[model samples]
Target: MNIAIVGLGVIGGSFAKGLQAAGYTNVYGIDVSESTLKIAVDQGMIKKGFIEANDILQDMDVIMISLYPNQIAPFVEQHKNRLKDGAVLTDVTGVKTTIIEKVSNILPSTVDFVFAHPMRGSEKQGIIGADHKRFIGANALITPIATNKEASLQLIEKLYKEIGFDQVTRVSPEKHDEQIAYVSQLMHVLSVAVVNSQQASEETLTYAGNSFQELTRIADINAELWSELFLNNRTGLLKSIEHFEIELDALKHTLEENDDERLKAIFRQATNKRREWY
Candidate 1:
């Protein structure tokens, strides 16, 4: 398949590498950065790279947009007509509702835009940090709108599997946002808060442990990207934050009251609940 990936950042760059590794030649990349384009070409991640949308997209079988949620709509709107007929387009943004709706509403009947979220990435930023290994055990969620045809969606599912994702599941845009709010967005908030809550002294730094490092690993995240994601899924993300706050308040009250049994019970429940993922 002739593929064009718009936005050659970490996710986009990684996707180009993954597609190339899967034996998909003719993979072209689009990015605003000239350096990124050159690097992508040099790394054999793409056959050609363009600084902007152009005629090369006219023959593309699939156009995978790996951009920020805010950029997804405008980019699709600007290039909708440039896409070839029967092209299967997809995205890898963290949040999906607004982007999917906006793009779906504007897309032509000749082309289909399928929304997907690959649950994989790193806290590191830019093309230099792109790593296809990130998707090794990740889940790829396909959030299809009514406009997406069965054949196109099925082809996308096959592509996800071909790209080495462990699982491929279909979900509505709404459900995808709600679930991601809890599983992904909330965790980033917790990590950021945990890192900020610390008041380290020179001596106290020596007492840091594995748990602290693990929990704060994602604290050094891309603030601009995360801020857009948080606002895009505001309602679901707010609800998740409220739920977390309530749990935290309960724990704080229990600790203040010196309720050892309650704390122990809470720990037991958390341990048991977490084991469910295994």
Candidate 2:
């Protein structure tokens, strides 16, 4: 298959490497940065690299757009006609509802857009940080509409599995966004909050332990990308935040009232829940 990856940043670059590792020889890359394209080709991650979408779009069997949430629809709209007929188009966008809806409306009937999210990433950004091994044992979620072809969905599932995903589960776009808001987005929010809550000096981090380091690791986030994700999924994110606030307030009340039993109950409940889930 002639697979092409658009926007060769961390996610796109990683996907290219993963595909190459899976023995895909016809992989191509597209990016705005000439330097990034050069690096991908030099590293043997892609067979060729293009600075922009050109005639190469016509030959691609599968195209993965790994871009920011807001740029997804616009990229499709701008290049819809350039995409090959019957080609499978997919994206790595975190939020799905708005993107799937908009892209579905604008996308050609001949092209299949199967929205997917690979549940793995790093604090680092761009091609320099790309790592094919990140997909190993990771989970992937596919949000397919009623109009998507069964063959296309199967192709994506098989591709992800070949590239090292442990599981590929099908889900509704609404459910995907809702669950992601809690698990992914909420986690990032808490990490950022934990880091920001402290006014750190050089000595402050020296005093930190493994737990603190682990909690604040993702706090070294790509601010612009995360800000867009947070706002794009704000409705679901806000709901999660509100729910967390209620739980936090209850903990605070327990502390203020000197309810030792209640505090112990809360701790026991959390421990049990964690044990059950993990």
Candidate 3:
């Protein structure tokens, strides 16, 4: 398969490496940075690299857009004509409702765009931090729109399975955004808030336990990338935050009223719900 991965950042670079490792020989890396392209080629992540959209992309069987949410539409619009007919286009972007709606309107019917989200990442940035290990046996979500082609969805699911995703669950864009707001976006928000709430110094970190470290691991985030994602799905994110606030207020109320039984009940319920995941 001739696969083209746009934006050679961490996720894109990881996709290149993962696909190559899975025996896909004709992987191509595309990025705006010439140096990044050269690095990708030298690292053997991709068989070829391009700094700009060209005739080479017309031959691509699949094109995966790994750009930030805000940049995805412009990238597709700029290179729409260069995309091959009957080619399957997919994305690893987190936010989907707006992206799926806008891209569907702009892209030609000759090509198929399958919107997908790979629910795996690190707090690191750039191709230098790319690792295919992060995706091994990870869960992938295929958020399909009404206009999406059945064949395109099948191709993307197969591609994710081949790249080592253990679970591939399909959902509508609405449900995807609603659920991700809690599982992904809201967690990032909580991490950032928790890290910033305290005034930490060297002395404070010296006493940090594994619980603190685990909670704050994702606190070291990429602001530029996350800002775009948060804004794109602001409504759902805000709703998730509201729900969290309600639960937090309830806990605070229990503590203020000295309701020991209520607090224990809440903790027990939370523990039971979490155990369902395992």
Candidate 4:
């Protein structure tokens, strides 16, 4: 397959390398930066690199767009005509409802856009941080619409698995967003909150333990990208935040009342619920 990846940033670069590792030699990359494209080609992650979509869109059998949430729809609209007939297009956007609706409306009948979210990433940014190994043991979620072809959905799932994802599950776009808001976005928010809640001190790390370090690792985030993700899924994320706040308030009340039994019960409940994931 002639696979083309748009936006040769961390995720895109990782996809290129992973696909090549899986023996897909016909991979290509498209990016706005000439330096990024040159680096991608020099590193042999892609067979060739294009600075613009018009240069390679027509020849690709599969197009994996690894752009920001806001950019996904526009990129499709701009190059929808250029995409090859019968091509399978997919994206790695974190939030999906708006993007799916917009792209689905504008997509050509000949092509299929299979919406997918690879549950893997790094705190680091750009192509420099790309690592195909990140997908190992990670889960991937596919939000397929009624119009999506079964063959195309299967192709996407197979590709993700071949590139190292351990599992791929299909769910409604609404469910995907709701779950992600809690599991992914809320985790990041908590990390940031924990980091910011600390008093500023250069010596803070000296007192930190493994748990503190691990918990705040994602606090070193891509602010602009995360801000967009938070805003795009505002409704779902707000609901998640409200739920978390309620739990936090209950804990605070328990502490105020010096209710040791209640605190222990709460901890036990949490531990039991968490153990189920394993």
Identify the superior model by TM-score, candidate 1 or candidate 4. 4
lDDT of 4: 0.93
Report the C-alpha lDDT of model 1 over 1-278, residue by residue, as the tens digit.
Answer: 79999999999999999888999999999999999999999999999999868758888999999888889888878888788999999999889887877777778899988888898878878899998888877899998888789999998888778888999999988999999999999999998987777575566458888988888788999988999999999999999999999999989989899999999999999999999977
Model 1 segments more than 4 A misplaced: 198-204
Tally clashes: model 3. 0
**Pairs that clash in candidate 4:** none
Clash list (residue pairs), candidate 2: none
Candidate 4 on 57-168: residue-level lDDT in tens? 9999999999999898899999988989999999998999988888888999999999999999888788988999999889999999989999999999999999999999
Maximum-lDDT candidate: 4
TM-scores of all predicted structures:
0.96, 0.97, 0.97, 0.97
Q: State the lDDT of candidate 2 residue by residue for 103-197, as single tens digits.
A: 88898988999999999977889999999899999999999998899999999999899999999999999999999999999999999998877
Q: Could you arrange the candidates by lDDT from highest to lowest?
A: 4, 2, 3, 1
Model 3: worst 10 consecutive residues (lDDT sum): 196-205
Clashes of each: 0, 0, 0, 0
lDDT measured at residue 93 in model 4 versus the true structure, 0 to 100: 87
Q: Any runs in candidate 3 off by more than 4 Å, and if so which?
A: none
